[model samples]
Target: MSSQPAIIVSSLDMDRIEALIEKMPRLTPEVEQLENELDRATIVAPEAIPANVVTMNSTVRFKFIGDDKVFEKTLVYPHDLKHDEQVSIFAPVGSALLGLAVGQSLNWPMPNSQSRTVEILEVLYQPERAGEYLR
Candidate 1:
């Protein structure tokens, strides 16, 4: 029973993520969490997703609750993670960022058995927003 907020996902991103999950040799807890998120997500067409929503390859600015630090990341597939600014979707924080819209928040479960509240400050570069949906 997490207090995680509802999420929306693009159809194309969902399809790609599902295919990646099927290829995984083992399903870890983080991966399982991602599966759960996907299961509960409201799926929408890429063209239909709002420009403010986070999609694959979106550059997002967010911050943890109770922390004044703001972090930026570009959500990407595993293969595309070659830089510090890019976060792989397989990672826990990355999974938590998916589908969140500006001003929305998520409860990310930490490895220390605690949770951190992450709030989306803005979506600087959404694929759909820039007309780069094929990514």
Candidate 2:
């Protein structure tokens, strides 16, 4: 995988993610990846986030590079995940998707010591864009 592209995360989301990380029982590779992302993130006020950027609770459309199949999923915290369509922030793909803007791509690490390129095609809904900063 190449160097990661720039990412922007909302301050509120960053705070919540940090708290969640603090409660984890152990540091998994996924957790470490998330921490790396958090460390490099450009944080902005919730209202200042671009509408096309994926934020916590945002529903996004994305696809693996070179794949014709596109998928839509909602990025959610662990406790709020209730179905297959929702991805926890602790998940590798979910962590990779956080803060990515529409048209941006990242090389997502897999458990098998491989990586896949994932591109953000669209952000269908973002809580910050909807004025739901407290969510």
Candidate 3:
């Protein structure tokens, strides 16, 4: 897994964060508070969607400039990438890819006022909600 900064999330792309949040073991009040702080730094990644978008750890695969492209591979998360796609846990687009759904777009700035858009065409898999659909 790349030490780069990115987001690691499961399912519910562009919707709910509770899926991954609920997976985390319950913690004490102090830990809970710290967890809140952690959320701020960590990005939330979403499941992969063929011909649309997929995020591993920090690495992100999406359609851009009218074509499919992979951005910031250094953030790929360690361990098996449960789905067919791989996302670096720490990448520019990985963190931003989470909590998003198809047809939605983000105009993120890339230094200066220059910015680009990321349009979600589809959400292929969301393990928590996918069920047999995953097969």
Go through the candidates in order and give each one's C-alpha lDDT. Answer: 0.91, 0.92, 0.40
Tell me which residue pairs clash in candidate 2: none
Worst 10 residues of 3 by lDDT: 51-60
> What stretches of model 2 exceed 4 Å from their correct place?
none
The numbered model that scores best in lDDT is 2
Tens digit of per-residue lDDT, candidate 2, span 11-117:
99999999998988898998998898889899999989999999999999999998899989999999999999999999888999999999999987878898888
lDDT of 3: 0.40
Error of 3 at 57 (Å): 8.6
Rank candidates, lDDT, best first: 2, 1, 3
**Residue-level lDDT tens digits of model 3 in 20-116:** 4455587434334323423643343333333223333223334544557633322233343455456522223444455345455654434344556
Per-model TM values vs. the true structure: 0.95, 0.96, 0.39
Model 1 Cα lDDT, one tens digit per residue, 81-114: 9999999998888999999989999988767778
Clash count per candidate? 0, 0, 19
lDDT of 3 at 58: 26
